[model samples]
Target: MTEISTLIVDGILAVLLVSVIVVCTIVYRRLGTIKSGQAELRALVDQLNTAVVDAQRSVANLKTSATEIEGRLQIEGKKASAIADELGLITEAGNNLADRIERGLSGATAAKKQQAPAETSASKKQQEEILAALREAR
Candidate 1:
Protein backbone atom coordinates (compact mmCIF):
# COMPACT_ATOMS: atom_id res chain seq x y z
CA MET A 1 0.00 0.00 0.00
CA THR A 2 2.84 2.46 0.82
CA GLU A 3 4.47 1.83 -2.58
CA ILE A 4 1.18 2.37 -4.35
CA SER A 5 0.62 5.73 -2.59
CA THR A 6 4.15 6.87 -3.54
CA LEU A 7 3.45 6.02 -7.14
CA ILE A 8 0.25 8.07 -7.12
CA VAL A 9 2.04 11.13 -5.62
CA ASP A 10 4.75 10.93 -8.32
CA GLY A 11 2.13 10.80 -11.04
CA ILE A 12 0.43 13.99 -9.69
CA LEU A 13 3.76 15.90 -9.61
CA ALA A 14 4.52 14.90 -13.21
CA VAL A 15 1.15 16.15 -14.40
CA LEU A 16 1.57 19.50 -12.59
CA LEU A 17 5.03 20.00 -14.21
CA VAL A 18 3.60 19.39 -17.68
CA SER A 19 0.81 21.89 -17.06
CA VAL A 20 3.31 24.58 -15.95
CA ILE A 21 5.41 23.94 -19.08
CA VAL A 22 2.38 24.35 -21.38
CA VAL A 23 1.32 27.62 -19.71
CA CYS A 24 4.86 28.99 -19.95
CA THR A 25 5.02 28.10 -23.64
CA ILE A 26 1.76 29.92 -24.35
CA VAL A 27 2.91 33.04 -22.46
CA TYR A 28 6.23 33.07 -24.34
CA ARG A 29 4.50 32.88 -27.69
CA ARG A 30 2.24 35.82 -26.74
CA LEU A 31 5.25 37.92 -25.68
CA GLY A 32 6.99 37.19 -29.01
CA THR A 33 3.91 38.31 -30.95
CA ILE A 34 3.73 41.56 -28.93
CA LYS A 35 7.41 42.30 -29.61
CA SER A 36 6.98 41.85 -33.36
CA GLY A 37 3.92 44.08 -33.38
CA GLN A 38 5.84 46.78 -31.52
CA ALA A 39 8.57 46.66 -34.21
CA GLU A 40 5.97 47.10 -36.94
CA LEU A 41 4.41 50.04 -35.12
CA ARG A 42 7.83 51.70 -34.82
CA ALA A 43 8.39 51.33 -38.58
CA LEU A 44 5.03 52.95 -39.34
CA VAL A 45 5.85 55.90 -37.09
CA ASP A 46 9.19 56.39 -38.87
CA GLN A 47 7.50 56.51 -42.27
CA LEU A 48 4.95 59.03 -41.02
CA ASN A 49 7.71 61.24 -39.69
CA THR A 50 9.49 61.17 -43.05
CA ALA A 51 6.33 62.16 -44.87
CA VAL A 52 5.72 65.07 -42.50
CA VAL A 53 9.24 66.35 -43.03
CA ASP A 54 8.84 66.21 -46.80
CA ALA A 55 5.56 68.06 -46.62
CA GLN A 56 7.10 70.86 -44.58
CA ARG A 57 9.91 71.21 -47.11
CA SER A 58 7.45 71.35 -49.97
CA VAL A 59 5.45 74.08 -48.25
CA ALA A 60 8.56 76.16 -47.74
CA ASN A 61 9.50 75.85 -51.40
CA LEU A 62 6.03 76.92 -52.45
CA LYS A 63 6.17 79.94 -50.22
CA THR A 64 9.48 80.96 -51.71
CA SER A 65 8.12 80.63 -55.23
CA ALA A 66 5.06 82.68 -54.33
CA THR A 67 7.25 85.43 -52.94
CA GLU A 68 9.29 85.54 -56.13
CA ILE A 69 6.17 85.72 -58.24
CA GLU A 70 4.79 88.51 -56.11
CA GLY A 71 7.96 90.50 -56.56
CA ARG A 72 7.85 90.05 -60.33
CA LEU A 73 4.23 91.09 -60.47
CA GLN A 74 4.95 94.23 -58.50
CA ILE A 75 7.73 95.18 -60.88
CA GLU A 76 5.54 94.56 -63.92
CA GLY A 77 2.72 96.59 -62.40
CA LYS A 78 5.04 99.55 -61.89
CA LYS A 79 6.31 99.30 -65.44
CA ALA A 80 2.75 99.21 -66.78
CA SER A 81 1.80 102.26 -64.74
CA ALA A 82 4.81 104.19 -66.02
CA ILE A 83 3.98 103.27 -69.62
CA ALA A 84 0.37 104.40 -69.16
CA ASP A 85 1.53 107.74 -67.79
CA GLU A 86 3.89 108.21 -70.74
CA LEU A 87 1.10 107.38 -73.17
CA GLY A 88 -1.20 109.90 -71.51
CA LEU A 89 1.41 112.64 -71.86
CA ILE A 90 2.01 111.70 -75.49
CA THR A 91 -1.73 111.83 -76.25
CA GLU A 92 -2.06 115.26 -74.63
CA ALA A 93 0.87 116.58 -76.72
CA GLY A 94 -0.61 115.13 -79.89
CA ASN A 95 -3.97 116.83 -79.21
CA ASN A 96 -2.26 120.21 -78.64
CA LEU A 97 -0.25 119.85 -81.89
CA ALA A 98 -3.40 118.94 -83.83
CA ASP A 99 -5.22 122.01 -82.50
CA ARG A 100 -2.31 124.24 -83.55
CA ILE A 101 -2.19 122.70 -87.02
CA GLU A 102 -5.96 123.16 -87.46
CA ARG A 103 -5.74 126.83 -86.48
CA GLY A 104 -2.79 127.45 -88.80
CA LEU A 105 -4.53 125.75 -91.76
CA SER A 106 -7.79 127.75 -91.20
CA GLY A 107 -5.86 131.05 -90.97
CA ALA A 108 -3.95 130.26 -94.17
CA THR A 109 -7.16 129.36 -96.01
CA ALA A 110 -8.82 132.67 -94.97
CA ALA A 111 -5.73 134.62 -96.08
CA LYS A 112 -5.69 132.85 -99.46
CA LYS A 113 -9.39 133.53 -99.99
CA GLN A 114 -8.87 137.21 -99.14
CA GLN A 115 -5.90 137.46 -101.52
CA ALA A 116 -7.82 135.97 -104.45
CA PRO A 117 -11.54 136.92 -104.35
CA ALA A 118 -11.91 135.84 -108.03
CA GLU A 119 -9.51 132.88 -108.33
CA THR A 120 -9.47 130.82 -111.52
CA SER A 121 -10.79 127.23 -111.49
CA ALA A 122 -7.27 125.93 -112.15
CA SER A 123 -5.96 127.74 -109.05
CA LYS A 124 -8.79 126.28 -106.93
CA LYS A 125 -7.99 122.80 -108.22
CA GLN A 126 -4.34 123.24 -107.29
CA GLN A 127 -5.36 124.35 -103.77
CA GLU A 128 -7.59 121.31 -103.33
CA GLU A 129 -4.75 118.99 -104.39
CA ILE A 130 -2.43 120.57 -101.78
CA LEU A 131 -5.08 120.12 -99.06
CA ALA A 132 -5.53 116.49 -100.03
CA ALA A 133 -1.77 115.84 -99.88
CA LEU A 134 -1.52 117.47 -96.41
CA ARG A 135 -4.44 115.34 -95.16
CA GLU A 136 -2.78 112.21 -96.41
CA ALA A 137 0.51 113.13 -94.71
CA ARG A 138 -1.32 113.67 -91.39
Candidate 2:
Protein backbone atom coordinates (compact mmCIF):
# COMPACT_ATOMS: atom_id res chain seq x y z
CA MET A 1 0.00 0.00 0.00
CA THR A 2 2.86 2.32 0.70
CA GLU A 3 4.45 1.68 -2.70
CA ILE A 4 1.18 2.25 -4.48
CA SER A 5 0.77 5.55 -2.70
CA THR A 6 4.28 6.63 -3.78
CA LEU A 7 3.57 5.70 -7.40
CA ILE A 8 0.34 7.67 -7.39
CA VAL A 9 2.07 10.70 -5.87
CA ASP A 10 4.83 10.59 -8.50
CA GLY A 11 2.32 10.40 -11.35
CA ILE A 12 0.44 13.47 -10.03
CA LEU A 13 3.73 15.41 -9.70
CA ALA A 14 4.71 14.59 -13.26
CA VAL A 15 1.32 15.75 -14.62
CA LEU A 16 1.51 19.03 -12.69
CA LEU A 17 5.06 19.73 -14.00
CA VAL A 18 4.02 19.17 -17.60
CA SER A 19 0.99 21.46 -17.20
CA VAL A 20 3.15 24.24 -15.69
CA ILE A 21 5.69 24.03 -18.55
CA VAL A 22 2.95 24.20 -21.19
CA VAL A 23 1.31 27.18 -19.50
CA CYS A 24 4.63 29.02 -19.24
CA THR A 25 5.47 28.38 -22.90
CA ILE A 26 2.04 29.58 -24.03
CA VAL A 27 2.37 32.78 -21.94
CA TYR A 28 5.83 33.47 -23.36
CA ARG A 29 4.62 33.06 -26.95
CA ARG A 30 1.68 35.39 -26.31
CA LEU A 31 3.99 38.01 -24.80
CA GLY A 32 6.25 37.79 -27.84
CA THR A 33 3.27 38.24 -30.17
CA ILE A 34 2.14 41.28 -28.21
CA LYS A 35 5.60 42.82 -28.46
CA SER A 36 5.66 42.22 -32.20
CA GLY A 37 2.24 43.85 -32.58
CA GLN A 38 3.41 46.89 -30.62
CA ALA A 39 6.45 47.26 -32.89
CA GLU A 40 4.29 47.11 -36.03
CA LEU A 41 1.88 49.66 -34.62
CA ARG A 42 4.75 52.00 -33.80
CA ALA A 43 6.11 51.69 -37.33
CA LEU A 44 2.71 52.48 -38.82
CA VAL A 45 2.42 55.54 -36.60
CA ASP A 46 5.82 56.80 -37.65
CA GLN A 47 4.92 56.40 -41.34
CA LEU A 48 1.66 58.26 -40.84
CA ASN A 49 3.44 61.13 -39.14
CA THR A 50 5.96 61.42 -41.95
CA ALA A 51 3.23 61.42 -44.55
CA VAL A 52 1.39 64.17 -42.70
CA VAL A 53 4.46 66.38 -42.58
CA ASP A 54 5.11 65.82 -46.28
CA ALA A 55 1.52 66.73 -47.12
CA GLN A 56 1.75 69.95 -45.15
CA ARG A 57 4.93 70.95 -46.89
CA SER A 58 3.36 70.21 -50.26
CA VAL A 59 0.41 72.36 -49.40
CA ALA A 60 2.65 75.24 -48.45
CA ASN A 61 4.59 74.97 -51.68
CA LEU A 62 1.40 74.89 -53.70
CA LYS A 63 0.16 77.98 -51.94
CA THR A 64 3.38 79.81 -52.71
CA SER A 65 3.16 78.85 -56.37
CA ALA A 66 -0.42 79.98 -56.53
CA THR A 67 0.50 83.33 -55.08
CA GLU A 68 3.31 83.76 -57.59
CA ILE A 69 1.04 82.89 -60.48
CA GLU A 70 -1.55 85.33 -59.24
CA GLY A 71 1.02 88.10 -59.12
CA ARG A 72 2.20 87.39 -62.64
CA LEU A 73 -1.34 87.30 -63.92
CA GLN A 74 -2.08 90.68 -62.38
CA ILE A 75 0.99 92.22 -64.00
CA GLU A 76 0.05 90.77 -67.37
CA GLY A 77 -3.47 92.07 -67.01
CA LYS A 78 -2.20 95.56 -66.36
CA LYS A 79 0.06 95.39 -69.40
CA ALA A 80 -2.83 94.20 -71.57
CA SER A 81 -4.99 97.08 -70.38
CA ALA A 82 -2.27 99.60 -71.19
CA ILE A 83 -1.84 98.14 -74.68
CA ALA A 84 -5.57 98.30 -75.28
CA ASP A 85 -5.64 101.98 -74.20
CA GLU A 86 -2.74 102.80 -76.52
CA LEU A 87 -4.50 101.06 -79.42
CA GLY A 88 -7.66 103.08 -78.72
CA LEU A 89 -5.69 106.34 -78.81
CA ILE A 90 -4.01 105.35 -82.07
CA THR A 91 -7.38 104.55 -83.63
CA GLU A 92 -8.73 107.96 -82.58
CA ALA A 93 -5.69 109.71 -84.10
CA GLY A 94 -6.12 107.80 -87.37
CA ASN A 95 -9.81 108.81 -87.52
CA ASN A 96 -8.87 112.49 -86.98
CA LEU A 97 -6.24 112.37 -89.75
CA ALA A 98 -8.69 110.77 -92.21
CA ASP A 99 -11.28 113.52 -91.48
CA ARG A 100 -8.69 116.25 -92.03
CA ILE A 101 -7.62 114.68 -95.36
CA GLU A 102 -11.23 114.45 -96.55
CA ARG A 103 -11.88 118.14 -95.73
CA GLY A 104 -8.69 119.24 -97.51
CA LEU A 105 -9.60 117.26 -100.66
CA SER A 106 -13.13 118.80 -100.73
CA GLY A 107 -11.71 122.32 -100.30
CA ALA A 108 -9.21 121.82 -103.12
CA THR A 109 -11.93 120.51 -105.46
CA ALA A 110 -14.15 123.60 -104.73
CA ALA A 111 -11.27 125.98 -105.36
CA LYS A 112 -10.44 124.33 -108.71
CA LYS A 113 -14.11 124.56 -109.85
CA GLN A 114 -14.20 128.28 -109.00
CA GLN A 115 -11.03 128.97 -110.99
CA ALA A 116 -12.22 127.08 -114.06
CA PRO A 117 -14.37 130.03 -115.29
CA ALA A 118 -11.43 132.49 -115.08
CA GLU A 119 -9.22 130.36 -117.42
CA THR A 120 -9.18 130.90 -121.27
CA SER A 121 -11.07 128.36 -123.40
CA ALA A 122 -7.82 126.98 -124.93
CA SER A 123 -6.31 126.58 -121.44
CA LYS A 124 -9.49 125.02 -120.20
CA LYS A 125 -9.43 122.52 -123.09
CA GLN A 126 -5.82 121.72 -122.32
CA GLN A 127 -6.69 121.14 -118.65
CA GLU A 128 -9.54 118.82 -119.66
CA GLU A 129 -7.15 116.78 -121.84
CA ILE A 130 -4.73 116.48 -118.90
CA LEU A 131 -7.50 115.31 -116.56
CA ALA A 132 -8.56 112.66 -119.11
CA ALA A 133 -4.98 111.41 -119.31
CA LEU A 134 -4.79 111.20 -115.50
CA ARG A 135 -8.03 109.24 -115.35
CA GLU A 136 -6.75 106.75 -117.98
CA ALA A 137 -3.56 106.23 -115.86
CA ARG A 138 -5.71 105.28 -112.89
Candidate 3:
Protein backbone atom coordinates (compact mmCIF):
# COMPACT_ATOMS: atom_id res chain seq x y z
CA MET A 1 0.00 0.00 0.00
CA THR A 2 2.82 2.51 0.79
CA GLU A 3 4.51 1.87 -2.58
CA ILE A 4 1.21 2.26 -4.43
CA SER A 5 0.57 5.72 -2.85
CA THR A 6 4.02 7.00 -3.74
CA LEU A 7 3.61 6.02 -7.42
CA ILE A 8 0.22 7.72 -7.69
CA VAL A 9 1.69 10.96 -6.18
CA ASP A 10 4.53 10.93 -8.75
CA GLY A 11 2.09 10.45 -11.64
CA ILE A 12 0.00 13.45 -10.54
CA LEU A 13 3.18 15.65 -10.36
CA ALA A 14 4.13 14.68 -13.87
CA VAL A 15 0.72 15.61 -15.29
CA LEU A 16 0.86 19.04 -13.55
CA LEU A 17 4.27 19.79 -15.07
CA VAL A 18 3.04 18.94 -18.53
CA SER A 19 0.03 21.23 -18.14
CA VAL A 20 2.22 24.14 -16.96
CA ILE A 21 4.56 23.72 -19.94
CA VAL A 22 1.66 23.85 -22.38
CA VAL A 23 0.26 27.05 -20.74
CA CYS A 24 3.72 28.72 -20.95
CA THR A 25 4.03 27.85 -24.65
CA ILE A 26 0.63 29.41 -25.37
CA VAL A 27 1.56 32.65 -23.53
CA TYR A 28 4.87 32.92 -25.38
CA ARG A 29 3.16 32.58 -28.78
CA ARG A 30 0.69 35.36 -27.85
CA LEU A 31 3.59 37.66 -26.83
CA GLY A 32 5.29 37.06 -30.22
CA THR A 33 2.05 37.97 -32.04
CA ILE A 34 1.81 41.20 -30.03
CA LYS A 35 5.40 42.10 -30.91
CA SER A 36 4.74 41.52 -34.62
CA GLY A 37 1.62 43.74 -34.46
CA GLN A 38 3.62 46.53 -32.81
CA ALA A 39 6.27 46.38 -35.53
CA GLU A 40 3.61 46.72 -38.24
CA LEU A 41 2.11 49.72 -36.44
CA ARG A 42 5.52 51.40 -36.27
CA ALA A 43 6.09 50.89 -40.03
CA LEU A 44 2.69 52.43 -40.79
CA VAL A 45 3.56 55.47 -38.66
CA ASP A 46 6.81 55.95 -40.58
CA GLN A 47 5.00 55.88 -43.91
CA LEU A 48 2.45 58.42 -42.73
CA ASN A 49 5.21 60.77 -41.60
CA THR A 50 6.90 60.57 -45.01
CA ALA A 51 3.66 61.31 -46.77
CA VAL A 52 3.04 64.41 -44.65
CA VAL A 53 6.48 65.79 -45.41
CA ASP A 54 6.04 65.28 -49.14
CA ALA A 55 2.72 67.10 -49.04
CA GLN A 56 4.29 70.08 -47.32
CA ARG A 57 7.03 70.29 -49.91
CA SER A 58 4.51 70.28 -52.71
CA VAL A 59 2.58 73.10 -51.12
CA ALA A 60 5.70 75.21 -50.75
CA ASN A 61 6.64 74.73 -54.40
CA LEU A 62 3.17 75.69 -55.53
CA LYS A 63 3.28 78.86 -53.48
CA THR A 64 6.57 79.85 -55.07
CA SER A 65 5.23 79.26 -58.54
CA ALA A 66 2.16 81.32 -57.82
CA THR A 67 4.22 84.21 -56.55
CA GLU A 68 6.39 84.20 -59.67
CA ILE A 69 3.36 84.18 -61.92
CA GLU A 70 1.86 87.14 -60.10
CA GLY A 71 5.03 89.12 -60.52
CA ARG A 72 5.13 88.41 -64.25
CA LEU A 73 1.54 89.49 -64.65
CA GLN A 74 2.25 92.78 -62.95
CA ILE A 75 5.17 93.43 -65.27
CA GLU A 76 3.05 92.71 -68.32
CA GLY A 77 0.40 95.07 -67.09
CA LYS A 78 2.94 97.92 -66.89
CA LYS A 79 4.14 97.21 -70.40
CA ALA A 80 0.58 97.31 -71.69
CA SER A 81 0.06 100.68 -70.04
CA ALA A 82 3.18 102.11 -71.69
CA ILE A 83 2.03 100.88 -75.08
CA ALA A 84 -1.37 102.50 -74.60
CA ASP A 85 0.27 105.81 -73.74
CA GLU A 86 2.36 105.71 -76.91
CA LEU A 87 -0.72 104.95 -78.96
CA GLY A 88 -2.51 107.92 -77.43
CA LEU A 89 0.34 110.25 -78.39
CA ILE A 90 0.25 108.94 -81.97
CA THR A 91 -3.47 109.57 -82.16
CA GLU A 92 -3.00 113.17 -81.04
CA ALA A 93 -0.35 113.72 -83.72
CA GLY A 94 -2.69 112.39 -86.40
CA ASN A 95 -5.43 114.72 -85.28
CA ASN A 96 -3.11 117.72 -85.40
CA LEU A 97 -2.06 116.83 -88.98
CA ALA A 98 -5.67 116.59 -90.11
CA ASP A 99 -6.43 120.05 -88.65
CA ARG A 100 -3.48 121.57 -90.51
CA ILE A 101 -4.54 120.01 -93.82
CA GLU A 102 -8.09 121.36 -93.41
CA ARG A 103 -6.77 124.88 -92.73
CA GLY A 104 -4.55 124.78 -95.83
CA LEU A 105 -7.41 123.71 -98.08
CA SER A 106 -9.65 126.50 -96.76
CA GLY A 107 -6.95 129.12 -97.45
CA ALA A 108 -6.42 127.90 -101.02
CA THR A 109 -10.16 127.95 -101.79
CA ALA A 110 -10.43 131.63 -100.66
CA ALA A 111 -7.41 132.67 -102.79
CA LYS A 112 -8.86 131.07 -105.92
CA LYS A 113 -12.15 132.99 -105.48
CA GLN A 114 -10.31 136.33 -105.24
CA GLN A 115 -8.33 135.66 -108.46
CA ALA A 116 -11.20 134.48 -110.69
CA PRO A 117 -12.46 137.92 -112.00
CA ALA A 118 -8.94 139.16 -112.87
CA GLU A 119 -8.17 135.94 -114.74
CA THR A 120 -11.36 136.30 -116.87
CA SER A 121 -10.46 139.88 -118.08
CA ALA A 122 -6.95 138.82 -119.07
CA SER A 123 -8.32 135.87 -121.03
CA LYS A 124 -10.70 138.13 -123.09
CA LYS A 125 -7.93 140.50 -124.22
CA GLN A 126 -5.76 137.53 -125.34
CA GLN A 127 -8.63 136.25 -127.50
CA GLU A 128 -9.11 139.66 -129.29
CA GLU A 129 -5.36 139.82 -130.11
CA ILE A 130 -5.53 136.34 -131.62
CA LEU A 131 -8.49 137.33 -133.82
CA ALA A 132 -6.64 140.43 -135.22
CA ALA A 133 -3.57 138.27 -136.08
CA LEU A 134 -5.74 135.81 -137.99
CA ARG A 135 -7.30 138.59 -140.12
CA GLU A 136 -3.88 139.93 -141.09
CA ALA A 137 -2.72 136.49 -142.15
CA ARG A 138 -5.69 136.09 -144.46
Better of 2 and 3 by lDDT: 2
Q: Candidate 3 vs. truth: CA RMSD?
A: 16.1
Clashes of each: 0, 0, 0
Which sequence of candidate numbers ranks them by lDDT, best first?
1, 2, 3
Return the TM-score for candidate 2, rounded to 2 decimals.
Answer: 0.55
Q: Write the per-residue lDDT of candidate 2 for residues 1-138, one digit (tens) a residue.
A: 999999999999999999999999999999999999999999999999999999999999999999999999999999999999999999788667656655655565567779775656775576556555544543
> TM-scores of the models, in the given order?
0.58, 0.55, 0.49
Error of 3 at 119 (Å): 13
The residue ranges of model 2 lying beyond 4 angstroms of the native Cα positions read: 1-28, 106-138
For model 1, the stretches where C-alpha displacement exceeds 4 angstroms are: 1-37, 117-138
Off by over 4 Å in 3: 1-41, 113-138
lDDT scores in order: 0.86, 0.82, 0.80
lDDT of 1 at 83: 100
- By lDDT, the better pick of 1 and 2 is 1
Best by TM-score: 1
Highest lDDT model number: 1
* Candidate 3 TM-score over all chains jointly: 0.49
Alpha-carbon deviation at 104 in model 3, angstroms: 2.3
Error of 2 at 138 (Å): 24
Q: How high is the lDDT of residue 22 in model 2?
A: 100
